[model samples]
Structures are given as structure tokens and as C-alpha cells.
Target: MAVPSGDQKPESYYVGVDVGTGSVRAALVDQRGTLVAFAEQPINQWEPQFNHHEQSSEDIWAACCVVTKKVVQGIDLNQIRGLGFDATCSLVVLDKQFRPLPVNHEGNSHQNIIMWLDHRAVSQVHRINETKHSVLQYVGGVMSVEMQAPKLLWLKENLRETCWDKAGHFFDLPDFLSWKATGVTARSLCSLVCKWTYLAEEGWDDSFWKKVGLEDLIADNYSKIGNQVLPPGASLGNGLTPEAAKDLGLPAGIAVAASLIDAHAGGLGVIGADVRGYGLACEEQPVTSRLAVICGTSSCHIGISKDPIFVSGVWGPYFSAMVPGFWLNEGGQSVTGKLIDHMVQGHAAFPELQAKATARCQSVYAYLNSHLDLIKKAQPVGFLTVDLHVWPDFHGNRSPLADLTLKGMVTGLKLSQDLDDLAILYLATIQAIAFGTRLIIEAMEAAGHSISTLFLCGGLSKNPLFVQMHADITGMPVVLSQEVESVLVGAAILGACASGDFSSVQEAMARMSKVGKVVFPRHEDKRYYDKKYQVFLKLVEHQKEYAAIMKGD
Candidate 1:
């Protein structure tokens, strides 16, 4: 990558930093949404105990600094117009004076972040769900253990002496990043409304908090969490603080946008792209016709509508959660990429497969896809998973069922532990994830969203097999963004909006997002996938039956 110089007429650019599950990735994206420079740095994650995931705010901030500096290495700092951040909606804790507060009883104060995936709040979530609070209806009728309310409750009950009692600020990670950048404590509506129980139209419900026994939040008027909220692209405070500017190696006072949840940032990046000339039905329809499926460590199916569309188990229909003036319904599969990694890495033939993949200079998944093609011969690769099926709830179902007790199940296993068996198992896992997406789409449509196409981004979208399987199984064309890291583009879109370079977020999205390619569903594979989906549904049915029988229900 060439260093962008100020020698020539300075060009407008935005810096987007994305904090993901396992790493911090930064991109220097031009106003046109092309990623000009990119860098990545891995962040630390600790499983101090099972189901309790924690990270350090200081460590994450350091990782963000590393990537942001690297991406801007050759760029003339003057050319950078704005900075934006998107991160996992993990909970970050700090003292009143703004010092890290330990989320765990024994861990260092640096380990203040309770990761979005942590399930320590399971009991708390169940109790909250039992309340049937009006807020529950906004969050798919069930408050997920993954969300902040339960996590906060868990802290109050279990870590009061160390954390909850002493804590002064509880931030969704995305908001924390913005506050880090601009020294602004206001939270983004994207985080507050989506993850916390802050309703976009009415703000927080005091009764719900008191009912859930976290009324301490109400006493402060929700200031510890967030009292003031702004939309995702709104400018924060005056801009980057001098201290943060020095840390990030960027100009002080550069426009810093109020950020978005990482997945929603991905949604903002690709969902608004001009899809004309793509020969897709979505081109002729309203933007509401397209669903943005941001698939990375997990997958979120976000679709926008003109009004609140109530899907029983799909979170949202929140106003302006992603796109302003649009009601966003977010459906999700809690673990897709992670589950794939678990299955592929845990198999008995994994060692053999790894060696073969390395010799071919390919990712294990790519190599496995090629091997499936080679073995399937004239038959379609999808046929290889005919006897095998996977239920991918290793992290529990996030949508369309809202059930957390569901465990992963695999049917049709032979005694043999061969490479072929491993490849087929990998294929089965991918198909199952696609089936999950299909279920989510059905739920969304049944509620009111007329989704005609899927706009895909995130790491999984790079896999041809994954993209094709989604297209084939969902029977919708998958549109790929010209900028493969659309989440970064989405983050940059926030910067563009903050800079006032565009009138609204919608304009920025239209100008920056571009269609790179389209994968059309293979109609010939329809019957096969339909049958597989039926079997996929049955697998979960049997899982529930088995659970009932064991419980003597």
C-alpha cells in the first residue's frame, strides 16, 4: 500500500477501527468507501472460568491504538477528516473517576469488560424473562443473557463487593470506544436501544429496572449506564481529545462519530449500497427489501422496515437501531464461525486435514471445500452432507426460538475417522448455519419484512462455499460489497456522517458502499436444500423431545 501524501491536493478520508471478538482491525477508507489501508492486531480474551468471558479495557484500547497507528502510517494526517469505531456490545466497567473496575471478584481491574458472548448471566436472564416486562417485547420477548441487563444483574448479585457497588460507569464497548476517542460520555442509540433496554422513542423504563431489582440505575437517572443518547453517526463532543489524539497518532479535534455495534456497523456499510445494474429484485424495491447478514464469529440477520415488525423471537424492530427512520429487526445465530472452527478442529482427522491444508497453502476450510468437490465428482457438493446433519446451538439459539437451553446435536456418524468424514462434517456445519439463516428470514418475513436479497459482509462472506450455501439454501442472491471489510466501511460511514461530508448517514452509505459481485441461488439445488432444511428442523425437534423425556416432562 502506498502512503497517501499531503503533497498532492489533500484527499478526504475516514479512519474506521473495528473491535471484533478476537482482534482489532483498522482501515483507512477513502470517501468513496474503498479501504485504502488496513491493519489488524489481536486482542486478549480470557475464559477465567467457563461461561465467563472477560477482557481489559486498557488492553483493548492499546490494541486499537496499535492498529489505528499502523493503518495511518503513510497517510498525511491532514488528509484524514474523521474517525469512527464499532465494537462488540460487551459491557465495560469503570470507576466514577474513570478507572477500570474489575468485573470479576479476583481478576485485575484491567479485566473490566464482560464480553458479549459470556453466559454468566443465564440465571439473571431467565428471571428477567419471567417478568414479561414491556421492554421484553422490544427484545424478541426474551432478554438474552448476552445483553447488558442480565450481565449487570449478575454483577450486582455476585460481584457487588468488588464491582457493582464501586462501579461508576457501565458502557457498552462501542460507547466506551467513542468516549475514549472524544471524551464524550453520551452513549449511542445503536448500543443503548439495541443491547440495553433503552427504548428509542421513550428512553429507559424506570419500572422495568425497579421490577428487575436494578433500581440503583434509576436513582442516578441512568447516568452510570447512559443518560444522554445519540444516533450512531452523530458527532461526539468536540472531537478527538488531545490525549487520545496523541495515543492514536492522529490530529487532535478530528471528527469522531458516535459509534455502532460491530454487526450493525457492517449492516450500515452494505445495506445501503447502490445495487442498480446488479440485476436483482432488490434493485427495483425499497431498501427494506434487502436483509443485511453480517457473519463473522457469529451471524446477525438485520432487516429494516417502515414500521415495527414483531417477530416473536427475533430481537428488535427497534426504531433507528441501524438505519435512521427505519425499524430494524435483528435476528441472529449465536455461533456460526466459531462452531465451524470447533467442529473442524475437534474432529479426529483434524491433524491429517491440517497437514494436507498446509501443504496446499490453503486455509483448512478452503482446502476442505476443494476436497469435497474432488470427492463429490459429478454430484453436487451439497450431496456429501446427505447422511450428516448438524444443529449449531453450541452457544444456544439467538433468534426464532429464543431458547438458551438448546445444545448442539449431530446425527449420522460412522465409526470411521477419515479425512472424507471430516470434510463432510465441515460441509454439514456450513449447511446447518445456512439453514439457521433460512429460519431467521422466515421469521422476519412472517412478521412483515419482505426480504428479497441478502447483503453479506464480515469474514464468512469471503468463503465461496459459505456464500454459495447461503444463496442456495435461502434462495436469495447474496450481494457482496466491493470493500470486503464492509464493517470498516460502515464504521467509516459513521465518520463521514460526523464530518458533515454527507447530509445524512443514508447519503454516506449510498456514496461509499458499492456492489462488487452477486452470487445467485442455484435453483437446481432447491429441492435438495429444502429437504435438508426439513431434516434440520427435525433435529431440533428431537433435541427438545430428548430433553423432555430425560426431565420426565
Candidate 2:
């Protein structure tokens, strides 16, 4: 493809690539962090067996190339100063020749990636947790089936011949992309500190790996995983390799910054913005007062403190995880947007809802929002779900409780199965997610982090009802970033920092990020939600009780 000649292109432009669970997206952002052009392409996934989600590193890189090329189609190549990538904290396996290794028993080498949502390692996670190792403390005092260690142990035990024995290098998806880009073996601190139990100060823990029965990694001085670790936004090697530059349609040797996990990128994209003009409590307070909720397929409630605040069942207190010079605490729901989709789409009235949504040229969610308003007439939307309550852990709880075995529960069912039923269920699910966020907040405060402002971004944040519900339930103003694609912008901020256009990630965030709209909690509705939140707690408690009775407790 020939580069288009435009009238005086900007002095510098950065490209941001985000690989979420479903799709890969690329955005061309200017030096000021404004998105100039964007494109997306879906990545492929395979489920060879139950609870096993896998992808191909080859396919992901190809999708990245396609989106990046399309987004920069008409831009001058010389104007592109740097590039950055952020992906889900999924694990990628490769052999000595940098070839994909089968992560599944099917022996499909193309499906070499173990997805972030995959839970085939539950047995492994349980065994590791039984050890109660000190390294487990960093990951919320208990390792969820999602982290790399559990997955690694599972591979060592189950897929030894198919994967473990053949695998030469292991990579979190973000580090895989950087290695693919610059041929650098260095891993991002963001990935290691948050997901791999790599302490920022002490590096890798040999005893932890040995105790976990994966001492093979320590044999080569941690070469298979990562030896040279760099912080996010730090430039790697000389720059992009000739092959990667060709695939991405960019100049060779352009700056490529160390990457971040997708959610942390969203945190970086919004949390550090100076909110002085927003008239929120955080305006007078510090960045510590703002909590960034990157809500997408899952929701991660990210907050930073000047010092470590240990909140049990919540991940972090990790230094420089999201923002440099701060201790990061992350609480999350394993399912939020995905839960809403599952509940809405599985309803009997979904066909009618889809038809109505298509006829109105609106999304199903948009149609539902309007439908709820019509039903409520003059009443607040929260009132529609007065009798209906949802527990929202269909995919398991990620925070406060940190229990993967806990299943979702829905109370107040009726014989009436219609559009109204679907709408109310939808409303209840969103409220459940909001209450989960509140639980995380209460835990944080109990641990001594004063969070007064809520910052939201991601696909779910685009829904007005979802945003408003979070504000009302939490009783805090929710700040929305001016840029809707804040994850991409966060990746670009890393690029901007690597390009030397900004001094640090903090400076880059404050300069490039801006607050657009603020949703304030309605005090009048506070009493109502306070009561519903109680019911939310009881549903979980009762579910646990039922499980115990069934098991002959």
C-alpha cells in the first residue's frame, strides 16, 4: 500500500492497538491523544473442550496488522512516531523456533494461546491455593483460576507432552506482541507484577516457582518467561523489526513501548486526568480519590494509593502497576457485560427485542433503555427492578469474595415472560454489577483507601443506565473520559511517552486525557438502593447456605 500525501501531516502520530477478548482494534492517535482514525477486526477463538478457550498468536498478530494498516491508510508513514500495544492477560506459548505450540489436547498448533477467561485450571488453582504460599498474597491472598501460575501448573500436569515439554517461551499476550514487534524478550512490569507474581523490587521468586512444581523456569535463570523486565512505556531494543514494520505498514525502527494489560491501560487512560474543573470531590482531592472502573466483558475496579493498602480478596497493592509512583489495588467482577448479554439474550422475548431494536436502528441495549423508560413512565429506572434481584456471578465473583465456585442467583421470578420481564432482568443484572462495585469500595475503605470519585470507560460505560446505576448505587460521581476508546488512548499514551512527546506516564495522562461527562448519584434514590443492596448480600449468603445443606453440612 502506498502512503497517501496529505497537506502538512502532523509532526508526530502514535498508534495504539488493543486486543480484547473478542476483537483486535487499532487507533491512530495524534500527539495530543485525539483519535484520528480507528479500525477493528475480530480474532478467532477455539474451545477444544469445556471451559478451555484458546486463540492463535498468529491470528492475533494478523488481526493487529489488518486493523493497524486500515487505521493508518491515508496517513504519512513518516508522521508515525511510535506504537504501543495492550492485550488481555492471556498466556501465549511458543517453541524454540518461535512457532506456536498446541495449548489444547486437540494438537492444533494454531490455537496456542490460553485465553484469560479459560478455567480449565481450576483443579490446579485449588492445589496451589492449598499451599498458601507467601507469593499468593500479591494476588488477593488467593489465586483465581485465571492467573498464569495455575495455568502453568495445569499444563505441567495435564498437557505435558502436547504443550509443556515442547514449549520454549511463555508469554502474556501483551509481552508476546512486544516481542513480535521489536524482537525484544523483555517483559512488561505491568504484566509480571499484576499477573505473574513478579515483584517489582525482588523480580521473580524462585522458591514460589519450585514449590508450585514449575522449577524448570528457574533452571535457565527465568529465560523461558522473562529475564529483562521493563516498565510500561519504556522503549525496547532498537525499535520495531523490519518484518513487523512491513506487516504493520510503518517505518522500520519506530519506537515500540513496553505494553500494559488491557484494563490497566484503561486505568492509565482516565485515572490521572486532573479533574479540577469537574466539580467533583476528586477535584479538591488527589488522584487517590478517584477509582477507575474499566468495564467491558469483565469489570476491574482499579484504585491507586500512595502507600500499600492490603484489601483481602482484592488484587494488588502492587507498585507501579497502573500508574507509576503509586500502589495499585484492583477489584473486579469476572462477569459484567457478558452477564448482561447472557441474561438478555437467553430470555424468551429476546427475538422480539431484537426485531424491535433492528426496526428502530438501535442496539438491543438502546432499545431496552427506551423500553424501561416507557414502562416506568415517570418513575426512576431503578424502581423497575424493585422486586427482581440478581447475584451476577454466573462466571464467578472476581473481588471481595474471590470465590470462583460461587454461582449466580436470581430472585423474584414470575410466570410472566415478556419484554417487560427481559427489561427488568436486564436492569437487575446491571444493578447487581453496581452493587458488586460497591462491595469492592467498602472493602477498600475498610482497608483505608478513601475513594470519592468513580471514573468509568469501556463498552458498558457507553450505556447511560449502566453508568447511572453505578453512580446511584455507589453514591459517588462517575467520571467518563472524553474519549470513548480510552483503552486505545491509554495504549497511545504509552506510545506518546516512548516518543518523548511527554515526560512521564503521569504527564502524558494529564495532558492527553480529559473528562467529558460526570454522572452524579441521586440522593433521593439512595435509600431505595441501600435496601436492595442488602437483598443482594442475602442472595449470596443464602446461596452459600443452600450449597452447604446440599453437601450435608
Candidate 3:
């Protein structure tokens, strides 16, 4: 990647840093959103126990510095105009002196991050749900165990001396990154409204806080969480601090924009792609007709509207959460890529299948897909999933049903431990995950979302079979972004907005994002999937019935 000529001004370059569940990625993007250089460094996560995941704030920041420096090496550091960050909405705990505070019971302060998937606070979440607060309506009327308040309450109850007494600040990871960069403690409304129970319209709900036994946060006037809330693209105080600038190997005063949750950044990156010539509904209709699907370890379905639409079991009605002034309704599958990995790698024939894949210079998944195709060819009629079905809720359902206790269900399993069987299971798993997306879309439409096109990003979008499966299952055209890392591009847009490169996020999105290709549904396969979807629904309905009978309900 070559740097621009010296005549180009310093404000021409922008940096977008994204902190995912396991890595911190940095991209050097131009004013037009072209990525010049990019780097990534893996961060450590500890699963001390089942359902408990944690990370270190000190370590994450160290990685941020390492990757940012690596990405900008040999480039004119002075030409880097602004920086923006997006991160998983994990909870970060720190002491008054900015030392790590233990978010776990073992008193290991280095494990200060309560990961977004951690369910250690399940009991706390249940207790909070009992309060029946009005603020809960925004979060689909049921606060998740994944949210910060429940985790905070759990820490306060179980690790009171180690965490509660010593903890002086609580931050969503995005805000934590910004504070680390600029020494500014203000939080972005994007993180607060989306993760924490900070209502955009009503601000922090004091009555709800008191009801949930977290009134201490309210007592401090919410300073520890965030006293000053700014929009996603607003500039933080006084740009980057001298100390941080030195640490990052950049100039002292580049703008640092308020941040966004990682998935929301993905939404911003693709949601605004030029649909004018694409023949999509967003091309002829309003922006509300498009749904942005950010697929990775998890998947979030983002639908924006002019008015707040409260869809039950969805995550929002969050005002200006993604695009400013438009409400965001976020639905998600807690496991997609993770589920596929579990399904494929956990099989008895995985080692042999992996060996075959290595010999062919193909991924194990690709090998499985090929084997599934062979099996389909052998069948005289019907599809690969003619009998097999999978429920794909190994990590629990995050949307539509909001059922965390739902376990994965697999039907049509044979005692044969052959690679072909593994392939069938793999195909079934893919179809199941796609069906889950369809279920979310159906639920959203039932509640008034006029979704017409599906825009996808992240790791799963690269898979041809997965992309086609989503298109086929949803019966909607799937649009891919020209920039492969749309999440990174989205984060860069924030820096672009803060540097005044664009007048607003809408303009920044329009200029910086572009569509690459479209995957249309296989019209001939509609009946095949429709029948399979019926079996998929029956698997869940049957699971519910069995559970009810066992409980004598």
C-alpha cells in the first residue's frame, strides 16, 4: 500500500480501529473510505468457567497500540487526520486510579472485561426482569443477561469487595477505547442506548435503576457510566492526548470520534450502499425497506425506521443508534459461525474429513459442501436435507423468541460415523441458521418492518454457500459491500465525520460505502426450502412440547 503524495493534507487520512471479541483490528482509510493499510492483533479472553468469559482492559489497549502502530508504519503519521473506534459492547471495569478491577469472583483484576456473551449474570438478569420497569420495553421488555447492568449487579453481589468497592468506573468497551485514546470519559450514545439501559428519549431511567438494585450508579449522577453522551460521530474532547498520541505513534492533536458498537458499525458500513441502480426496494422505496445483517461469530439484523417500532424480543427502538434521527430495531442470532464450527468440528468423522480437505487444499467446510453435493447427486429426488434438520440454538436464541434455554436439536442422525453423514449434518446446520434469519425477518415483518433487501457483512458473508443459503432461505436479494471489511469501513466513516470530511453520517456513508455483488435466491429451490422450513419450525415446537410434558406444565 503506497502513501499519498506529500502535497496531500494531513486531514486526508483517517484511522478506524475495531475491537472484536477476540481481536483488535486497525485500518488506515482515506477520506473516500479506501483502505490503504490494515493490521490486526489477537487479544486474550479467559473462560474461567462455563458461561463466564472475561478479558483484560490493559491487554486490549496494549494490542490497540501495537496494531495501530503496525498499520501506520512508513506512512506520514502527520497526515493521519482522525481516529475512530468500534468494539464489542462488553463491560469494562476500572478503579479510581484507572487500575483494573476484577469482574470475576477470583479477584484477578486483570480479567476486568465481562464479555458480551458471558452469562454469569443470569440470576441478576432474572431478578431485574422481575422489576417490570418501563425502560425494559426498549430492550424487548426483557433485559438480557448480556447487558451491563445485570453483570454489574452480579459483580456487586458476588465480588463486592474486589469489584464494587474498588471499581470507580464502568464503561462499554467502545467508550473505554475512546477514553483510553483521548482521556475523555464521555460515552457515545450509540453504546449507552444500545447496551446499557440508557434511554435516548428519557436518558437514564432512575426509577428503573432503583428498582433493579443498581441505584448506586444513579447516585453518582451516572458519571461512572457516562455523564456526557454524544452522538456516534461527534468529536471527543480536545482530540488525542499527548500521551496517547505518543503511545500510538501519531501526531498530538488528531480528532477522535465518539464510537459505536461493532455490529452497529457493520450496519453503517453496508446499510447506506448506493442502491439507486441496484433495483432494490431501497432504490425505489425508502431506506426502511433494507435490512443490514452483520454476520460473524454472531449475527445482528438491523432495521431502521422513521418512527420507533417496538418489536417484541428485538433489542431496540434505539433512537439514532446507527443512522442519526432514525430508530434502530436490532434482532440477532447469538450463534451462527460459532454454531457451524461446533456442528462440523464436533462430529466423529471430523479428523478424516479434515485430512481429505488438506489433501485437496480446501477448507473442511468446503469439503463438506462438496460431499453434500455428491450425496444430493446420489439421491434420485428431493434435496440434501430431504430428511435431516437442525435447530442451531447451541448458544441460545437472541431474537424473536428471546429463549436462552433453548438447546440445539438435531433430527435424522444415523449411527454411521461417516464423512458423508458429517456433510449432511453440516448442510443441515447451514440451512438451519439461514432459517433462523428468516424467522427473525418474519417476526420483524409481523411487527411492521417492511424489509425488502438483505445487506450482509463480516466473516460469514465470504462463504458462497452461506450467502446463497441466506438469499434462498429469506427469498430476498443479498447485497455484498465492495469493501470486504464493512465493519472497519463503517468505523472509518466515524473518523471521516469527525474530521469534517463529510457534513453528516448519511453523506459519509453514501460516499464511503459501495455495493460489490448481489446474490439472488434460487427461485426453483423455493418449494424445497419452504418444506424444510416447516420441519425446522416443527423441531422447535416439538422441543417445547417435550419440555412442557417433562415439567408437567
The 0-to-1 C-alpha lDDT of every candidate, in the order given, reads 0.93, 0.91, 0.88
lDDT for each residue of candidate 3 in 1-553, tens digit (9 for 90 to 100): 4554678644478889999886899999886677888898999999999999999999999999998998889887777778999999999999988888988768888999999999888889989988888888999878878888899899889988878978889999999999998999999999999989887777898888788888898866887788899999899999999999988887888999999999999998898878777666668878889999998888899999999888999988899988999999999988888888888889999999989999999988778767766777655222777888899988778898888888999988788999878877888888899999999999899989999999999888987788889998899999999888889999999988887778999999988888999888887888888999999999999989999999994
Score residue 389 of candidate 3 by CA lDDT: 88
Off by over 4 Å in 3: 1-11, 378-382
Measured on C-alpha atoms, candidate 1 has an lDDT of 0.93
How would the candidate models be sorted by TM-score, starting from the highest? 1, 2, 3
How many residue pairs clash per model?
0, 0, 0
lDDT per residue, candidate 2, 238-319, as tens digits?
9999999999998899999999999999999898776877788888888899899999999999999999888899998789
Model 2: runs farther than 4 Å from truth? 1-9
Candidate 1 residues 257-343, lDDT tens each?
Answer: 999999999999999998888799988999999999999999999999888888999998699988899999999988998899999
Candidate 2: Cα lDDT at 438: 98
RMSD of each: 1.5, 2.0, 1.9
Task: Tell me the lDDT of model 3 at 396.
Answer: 77
